[model samples]
Target: MQLTAIGINHDTAPVALRERVAFQFEQIKPALALFKEAWSGKRSLSAPEAAILSTCNRTELYCATEAQSSREQAVSWLSQYHGIRTEELAPHVYALPQSEAVRHAFRVASGLDSMVLGETQIVGQMKDAVRTASEAGALGTYLNQLFQRTFAVAKEVRSTTEIGAQSVSMAAAAVRLAQRIFDKIANQRVLFIGAGEMIELCATHFAAQHPRELVVANRTAERGMRLAERFNGRAIPLSELPSRMHEFDIIVSCTASTLPIIGLGAVERAVKARRHRPIFMVDLAVPRDIEPEAGQLEDVFLYTVDDLGAIVREGNASRQAAVAQAEAIIETRVQNFMQWLDARSIVPVIRHMHTQADMLRRAEVERAQKMLARGDDPAAVLEALSQSLTNKLIHPPTYALTSAPANERYLLKEIVGRWYSPR
Candidate 1:
């Protein structure tokens, strides 16, 4: 079996394409189950170990399966699941094998692969994906080990390197953009959609600026209220958004909704209510909380996750030294993981060798016992048992060495030498 990481991310595909492939938080468990089933069917093997990490920036399937399953099979499964054509996905997909997959996982968890360099939220996101896959029984020895080691590598990188220091997070970037639209965030009323981690994060940043009013709107009022109270803000049900939209000067949204929530008409109505006052909006959700057309309105400043790329990249220049340090750490960890994977590859062969040796020992012992029971000398029986065991154990290699073709003898000799060599 081999380890593989297959998917498209912000680096490989545009936000529109990434959104098409993005798996919602609730969809992860079912998607993993479906992937395993489809993978086993395609490869004609047992279901492979699998885990998915889906976030605003990427959707990746990390799997361990036999060589019979090609990387193309994985891509086919993803495209099929998301209802896209293989050809369409082929251009954007990056299929990494073994060590590259391990390296990708390490880089991602360590925040080296984030849109906002060295942002630590991806570690938690990865953990959540692993947990979901495990709960779905999609994880096996390989994936479990991969995630465990990945988390360890991320921790080590964060501790030993300055990768996260002064890093500009997505939340911070959103606030930075809001600042560009509004001279003083403190004077603007801010509304956040969804009470998830991203909302919580953005709320914290915005609250630091002491927005005139901070409100959280969510499907579940209780969760929204809980999140809002953390920043001494108020909560409103999502149903109130359209009616109350005009009240907020800035809107930052991140939700798991599979479709756009804030549409063009709704924003137009809100704009009219506000007497055409400019409202800055950030759609951090993969599918996007606000409709793309809403950005066309004269009084609306709309920015999606992709729009923040330039601002996020600004932090990269200062983080070069830390990035180099993190890369060094990731490289060392990748080598260690590859060594472990290599050892795992030989385990079955080692097991078969032990099984064969045990079988030979058992057969010789049985013969020796019968010989002794039939009144044969104990020493003769013991000698015969030793000869039988030694001959049987070396039979395959010895026969190969003697019967090997002239052209193969040198290679056979090397094999025999290694087999009998002292450690």
Candidate 2:
């Protein structure tokens, strides 16, 4: 069980680079299969067990490998697959092995590692990633145990600590950002692009203000309408955004689109129509829904996921206590998980001991049976059998102890006691 977590996160890489490293939802399973196939039966590498967790804030690949050097090879595979140069990707990547990997995993799942500290959405994303890995035949014994324990640790951290208390959610941060530009949210026309979970969260937060007009633009009109109807708003086809872009004072977009949905040209025309009225935009999608260049417009206050990180960090002094408590809990659990991994490492040794003992027992029993068949005293044969089994069990250890150097005798004696002592 040589476990390693390799990849970049919000702490190590900027959003621009993180997006390049990210795995889209539809690409993960096949990419994982390809990852294993790339190194399958290679001289220096074995088939690896892998799972990827990719979100707006981070992209991480957790893997189990055999060779220590193979970890580096895994990193190379990731870089090559994403078309990133090794030197380009190397500085931002982190490769944590065994105990470090265990600690990293526990921290990540518990929300201690999120850009928005103690955010719960990552838990769901991680579960979805693991489920995909399982369906793709990439998860095996080691990764399976790691994630199961990871989930349990996350649940415990959330329940036992106030780590999530006073948390600034991304949606709340968006509203806060909006308030900075507009005096009253109720006075603004808000448009949300895409009808996903993130969009739902932002819409819910903004709806509390009873905005003047709320509209959801989505590719699927029915689903968009269903979501819009909940907030007493309306839905529009995504294609209409180009012509209607000027109608809204604020736009927040998060979709699975591989390219920018809100282009610079659309925003420029919208700005001209508004006579440069300030428009606050949040591009929450990974590849980015809004063009990065659009942020240069005078009326546009464009905030990417990275920008919200600063807004979310404003009141962290209060969470220091809860963060400390969660760290303590995670440390203890990390040690326990490492202990389990250590025990697994010696399983073959334990199996060997059991096999040898079984062979000796069978040989002694066969001798006793032969004696009984020859009309020898049954009690005598049984007594001899018992003595022989005991002697055979202790013989190897006794010989080793006698032959061992004087300096090694103490350690050998201790091992003997451990081996023969009752559980």
Candidate 3:
């Protein structure tokens, strides 16, 4: 079987495309089931082992299959599932096989492949995706082993290297950019949407700046209150945003909602209510919590996840050496994984060999039992059985060695020698 990684990421596609291709957290289970059903039907066998890793920056499908051409099939399935044309989607897709796939998985887990270099959030996101896949019954030995090693390599890299130092996360970048706009975060009123990890991080950073007032709005009031209380902020229902948005100078949103929650009309109304005061906004969601049109407003400084790329790159120069170390470690791990894959390939051959030997032994034992039943001498029967078993065990190699061509005989000799006395 071959290991394949097929997908597109922030490097290859714009957020406009990335958001369109992204699978919502709730959509993953059913999508995986559909993929498996289609894959098994197309291949005329059970579905190949598969897992999907989708985030704001990337969407990837990893598979282990005997059919090398499954890459194309996967792309087709993705396009069909998302209702996009294959031609439009194929341009940004990358299909990595074997060692390249292994390398990519390791790099991703290590945060070498994130928009924010060495960001630790991707690790949790990957684990969550894997858990969903496992619940969906999409994982098998190959993908399970691949992810386990990917996690181990990530842990080693983080502990032994400085890849995460001086790293500016999206949340930190948002705070920095807001500082540029507001001069003093202590004077600003901050509003956070959703209670996810991103929102929590952003809240922590902004709270440290001593914002005058902080508020968290979420679909679930209980969850929102929990996160809000952590930073000494108040909680509000998402439905109240239209009325309450004008009160905050800084708005940060990251949610799993498939559609935009903050629209042009709502932001326009909020800007009007605030007497055209500047409102700095950061949207960390993939499909986007804020509308694109909101960015066009003069008083609304709306920045999407893609807009933070430049800010996140600010301190990356210092991480070059650490990236090199991480790469070296990843390369070694990739080679080890490939070696394991190679060993797995010969398992069927080993099984066949054992089966043949067992059959030969059973046949010899039955013949000796017949001889004993016919009143043959027990000592002679035992000796003949032992000699016959030994001869049968060595017959194939013995015959091939004696009948081999002169040039091939030396190669056979080495193999036969190893069989009797392994190195």
Candidate 4:
């Protein structure tokens, strides 16, 4: 079987495009089933295993199939489902096969490929995606084994390296950036526009400063209220954002909406209402909840995912020793995994050889029984049996040595001799 990964990530595409393709956890099962059905029809391939990983930074499909056609079919299905132009999406996507795919998965699970280097959240996200795919009937033996190993590798990387220790999270970086703009975080009014994990993290950081006021606006008021209550803040319906936007000095938004929730015009009005007071805004959503044009306003400061990357890089020097150790571990683990894969590829050949040997052994045993029944000498029967077993064991290799090409014969001799020679 061939293993492949096709997807776009923060490095390849902007949040605008990434958000358009992101799938929520609840939507994954049905999506995977549909993807598998479409792939099987187009490629004429049997049931292919598939799993999708979608985060704010990436949307990827990892698959195991019998042929290359299955990989192409999966790519086409993803492009069609997201309504993204194939030409535009193709360049950003990386399609890895076999060993390369295995390496990519290991690196990703270890957080080497994350936007925030060494972020631990991605491992849980990967696990969730795997669970969802299994429930959707998309995971088969190959993908199941691949993902299980991925988790183990992630655990090893974290335990051996300080990759996670010195890294500043995006949420914490957002607060740090806001502090640079304002004299003190306690003097700013912070507003969070979603009730998701990212928003919760941002709220926690900002609340530590005891901001003047904290508010949460969400599509679901009940969810918003629960999150806001934890910080001793207030919650507002998304619909109320237009009128209430002027009250906050700092805005951090990360919502699952396909379209921008806060636009240029709304920000313009908010600035006018506040008499042109400076506002710090961070758009953490993949397809940003805040409008891109808002970054152009004179009194508005807007930072996207790319902008926060530098701030998160602080203190890397302290972690270099740990990173070196982690990389060495990953390299050794990768070699071992590849060895397993190589052995797996030859299983059918090994089985066939064992079957042939078993057939020859049974025939010789039957002959010996007949000789004993006929009252032949026991010593003669034993000698014949030993000679027959030796010949049968050597027949295939001996025949090949005579008939094979010179290079192949030389290679086979070396292999067979080494395998059978005394230690």
> Which one is best on lDDT?
3
Regions of candidate 4 where Cα sits further than 4 Å from its true position: 68-74, 314-318, 357-394, 418-423
Error of 3 at 36 (Å): 1.7
What is candidate 3's lDDT per residue for 108-142, written digit by digit as tens?
A: 99999998999999999899988999999999989
lDDT of 1 by residue, 1-423 (tens): 789898899899999899999988788888888888887876678989999998999999999997644778888888888899999998999989888899999999999888889898999999999999999999999989999999999999999888999988888899999999889999999999999888898999999999999999999999999999999999999999889999999999998899999999999999999999999999999987789999999989999888998799898888899889889988998999889988998999999999989888888888898999999999999898998788787888889889999999999999889888999
Model 2 lDDT tens row, 51-78: 9889988888888877663657777888
Residue-wise C-alpha lDDT for candidate 4, range 316-396, written one tens digit per residue: 557778767777777788788878877887998999999999999999999999999999999999999999999989988
Q: Pick out the ten consecutive residues of candidate 4 with the lowest summed lDDT.
A: 67-76
After superposition, the stretches of candidate 3 with alpha carbons farther than 4 Å from their true spots are 399-409, 421-423
lDDT of each: 0.90, 0.91, 0.93, 0.87
TM-score, prediction 4: 0.88
Residue-pair clashes per candidate, as listed? 0, 0, 0, 0
User: Which is better, 2 or 3, measured by TM-score?
Assistant: 3
